[model samples]
Target: MTYTVNCSILLTELPLLERPAAAKAAGFDAVEFWWPFTASVPADAELTRFEQAITDAGVQLTGLNFNAGDMPGGDRGLVSWMGRSSEFKDNIDVVAGIGGRLGCRSFNALYGNRQDGQTPEAQDELAVQNLAAAAEGVARIGGTVLLEPVSGAPRYPLLTAEDAVRVISRVKEQTGAANIKLLADFYHLSVNGDDVAAVIEKHAKDFGHIQIADNPGRGAPGTGELPLGEWIARSRQLGYEGHIGLEYKAPAETAFAWAIRQRIAQ
Candidate 1:
């Protein structure tokens, strides 16, 4: 099995620019992140420094999230939000530029929370358009655009594998874009009450990437009730060939110990 550290969530204790080196020092050769910038288009210097950090640390950037707005302030994403379509579209170029330089071929596009005034039908239509645009943008490098069902945000409507796949099918049907796919984050699915095993058994081959964190506490594998190792093994057995993204939260110093043990045991 292969793993990639999600520096954005796992290495929150460190400065943003330093997390790549920290991940490399901890023995991971590949890492992923949410959009590290506050703005859709950060300054050239900021982009340079970020790219340089990854290059200097010698780690592969395997996955990245497209800029979702104000995550900590409870904004899930911008793709479907009313009046933010231009902001979301602007972000595609930046995402593509970074991915082009860093060899990242998978980009996660968080479906935004439903706005107060916009009808659900309106939001879904806009989401499909933006997702199709994202898919086309990343296709230049043989990249994939990922859609995930999230937990804890009630306004965000995509809550099951079926929900995400429905939109993916729409993108394909409307735009003829085959590059959009599902991002199966086990923690989110479990928290949202989806049968994780059944999801894997049925849709493992459709996943563009997989992220993991144990539920109840969103902690590392051993600190919670999830059979994470078994699920990962099952995913691989069912033909999910991409890296397993370690997107759990824990004390940075000890976060990876269980993962190391799992690897040795495997």
Candidate 2:
């Protein structure tokens, strides 16, 4: 299994476009993004700059994220995808085109919000529907969309491993795209009361990628009580080979960098 670090870990020092260089310097095989293209919305020039950074670093471009819609628009992103009446599918197209140009093969997206007055059953149906749209976009470019569950978005339908797999399976069955899959994020899973390795093993096939940080603190692995090393070993034992994304805040760059190297070596 290869370990990848999210440039968000050092967002301040690493320019948005230069994140790949920084990640490679720190010994990561690849890098993940959280809406970095969002640094310049719909701007082709800025996206091009990002493309060059990855090339300069010689690091594999692992994943890019779709827009986080629950922000200013209060669920406009997920709602757009959910309702199927809007242009949510079109939004994913932007990610596919941009990520493809950047040599990235994967993208992450969310179900979004728990808006007031929206019933759980209704939101679930919407989530399944939107997944089909995402699948369509991925199919066009031979790419993938990793659907993630978040504890923060309680109103959203996908908030657990089981929920994510069931919905993802339904979408795959319908679209036969083979690209739509689950994103097993440890921070979110810990927040939602699930064992990290256990859930990961059960859903390994559906796992598009993996993200890690210690529980409670969500800091770098060695900083907290999470037995990250043991779990990583278990993942390897289970025959799982994919990117392990470090999406935590490090206490200090120099110290965190050292610890990360040690963890990966283990």
Candidate 3:
């Protein structure tokens, strides 16, 4: 499997439109991002410029997230939230359009945090429904819908590969769409105390994409204790031929350099 930079986390030094070029300059041929625009349905001009920027940079957009509310703040996702269902529906076609334009085949749909009055059962019911809808929409364009296990406060529901795969199974059963797949993010699994190697061995076939970040610090590969490069190599050995997204926090200009150097050393 090849590597792709997560532009949202890696190149904050440049404007959103310019990050793809920055990734290209760093020797990456592909990039991914969370929903870059605050609006679910951004103006066409904004979309055009984003497309142009990637086209000019000659970097492929390998993955993207649908609008997940405020990412920098505490909001993890919007798709499964009760009140935000309409907002997520509004984002579906728009996200599909962008992904279709860029030839991006995978999209991450974050399962939002648990609400106070909302029972886990209700949230789960809604998540399956929303994921089914998302799957149907993206399927029209031959794209796969991704569900990731995000690590954070205790309120977040999906914290392990098992958690995410359960949800993926529900959505697939609900829609009968084979396009629903798991996003096995090793950092979150490590943070949540799951055996990452066990997850890879068991769920490699379920994975549509994979992301990595070192544990303890969530920094570049060489800066932490996790055997990230080994896991990455292991993923490939396990038959996961998707992008290994560089979704860690590290200083710009040096992050990819360090990761590449560490891979070489390994």
Candidate 4:
């Protein structure tokens, strides 16, 4: 049960390029992030700099997200959005390429919110097509594709562990791509009223990655009532040997103290 910081949320006080060093300074040797740029296909120089930043900081890039459109502006995902399918398709290789370069072996593709005019069936069909391709792209780099059940955005379809696992199953069936796996984010599942323990008990082996944040506030572990440490121990008991991503909100100054406490406790 190792831990990695989610730089996208933890260290906003620093520039994006500096977060890895900051995480390392805070006693983390590994980190993960959402798409760091607004564009899916950022310039090669930009990509190189991002990779260099991580290298210079000496922290492992453990996981990354496929470009989900406009994360700061509330666009939950782009691939499943009707007209943006092509954009999403084009970015699959870009994300995988970066992952390969960084040795990051896990990628999460968010299932976007339901559009007003599109039927759920249609959106789901498009997701299967895109995720299948995403799975293949990451597989080429010896990586795995992850499906996360994100909560807080009410319109996003995938809200529970079961919901994400359902999609993962479908993508595997449709694409014959066995690299697809679930990203079990405890905060989201608890926020959506799912039994977190039950989810871990049932699908721990099925999980490709595990992210954690306290519910109700989406903050550090002690900020809420969820038994964060207990759940993590349960995950270990169930045989999940992957990194536990610290995907919680905290100011840069205090980001890793709680995390370090948890790590020491483990």
Candidate 5:
């Protein structure tokens, strides 16, 4: 049997359970999503149910993203509503619970707006504290945090790799947990003043997960300006053995399937 490289199928605006089966049919061994609390997802189910679905569907959820507070991509941050602590806790716990159930290897954090009247240092401290708390819960279930940096998003106000590296160092320092790490999204990094493969090499140690999409237009592999084949070759050469998430939106699964096979053939 030919061993296939593991890649994650991004599940956005799709039925949750169907995502895995669809991904499996598309020739992918794993799947991913920005958030899974929607009605279509498995947020209400217990941990066992989540586990059973993935096992039965033959899909592995490499990572799950936390609520990207105050952005089009997410639920507002924990502190967005100060007086409603329970709501915030519920949201976070729901995410953590799913991570635990699915054996999620990493968690993605979308840095949203800093709290009101807070200095940069204070906001940094706040993020570290929150991550540490979440990490503690995730540790029991064998999962880590993978913070993301995006361009043109409120969650990514800084929008640069240097900034992301700074956040990673602080997150690790605060959590002091081995599992808390980073997700390197090529499309965002390429827009945020980082060379695609060069940044991958520079901070590969901090990267616990990776994702990709074509620039100018978020599309299939062959439609982008990135030298994806070269990127994939170097990633393998550098000893990276984690999921390569295809977060782009394709018009149909046909292109996605073709892209995966193309990468594998290369």
Candidate 6:
């Protein structure tokens, strides 16, 4: 199986700019990240340095997230936030510029937590608009906008494949854009109680990208109860051809030990 290191989650031991080289040293040919900036539009120099790090490391930037606000502070995303639509829209160009430069064609747009002041109908409507705009922005580079079903954020509405696909279908139907797709994350799907095997069987061909982490603890494969290897194999059998993103939490020193074990097992 081809794997891409999710530098944002895996290489926290190093400074952000240094993670690309670390991933390269760790034997990964590609890397992915959440938005690696405090603001939607960072300064030019920050962008330059970020691009240079990936370039110098000789690794492909395969996936990136649109600016999801204050991730650690519990801001899941801005897409459905009642008053933050502009912030989400403004982020599209920055994302496109970085992805365009780094050869990243897949962008994850986290649907924000539901706001107390707004109706679900209102938020869903805004999300379709913003996602459609995002799809259009990245289409210049033949990019695909990815909608993921995330776990752990209680207010995050998309916690099942059906939920995310509903939104994806809405974006395509409303905007006539075919570049939007689902990011089937095995860990999140399992945590949310989705039928993982059924998801892969029915929707693997629809995935724009796939990410993995063992469930229960979100650790490296074999450290948790989830049968990630079996699920991944099934996904491949169903024709999902994207690199599997390693987006689990573990000490950087021992993160890839499971990969070694998997190789030996094979």
- Displacement of the residue 96 alpha carbon in candidate 2, Å: 1.0
Pitting candidate 2 against candidate 6, the one with the higher TM-score is 6
Per-model TM against the reference = 0.98, 0.84, 0.96, 0.96, 0.80, 0.98
Better of 2 and 3 by lDDT: 3
- The whole-model lDDT of each prediction reads 0.92, 0.69, 0.87, 0.88, 0.62, 0.93
Candidate 2 Cα deviation (angstroms), residue 82? 5.8
lDDT of 2 by residue, 1-266 (tens): 47776875555465677667767776676888776644324677766777777888888878877776534344524632434435556567777887677667778877676556667667666766676777777767778888787665545556688877787777667666567778888788878887777885776655778788877777777777777777667766776677888788764366256555777888
lDDT measured at residue 199 in model 5 versus the true structure, 0 to 100: 75
Q: Using lDDT as the measure, name the better of candidate 2 and candidate 4.
A: 4
Better of 3 and 5 by TM-score: 3
Candidate 3 accuracy as lDDT: 0.87
Candidate 4, lDDT over the whole model: 0.88
Candidate 1, residue 211: lDDT = 94
Model 4 stretches astray by more than 4 angstroms: 262-266
The number of clashing residue pairs in model 5 is 1
The predicted structure with the larger TM-score, 4 or 5, is 4
Ranking by lDDT: 6, 1, 4, 3, 2, 5
- The model with the greater lDDT, 3 or 6, is 6
Q: Candidate 4 vs candidate 6: which has greater lDDT?
A: 6
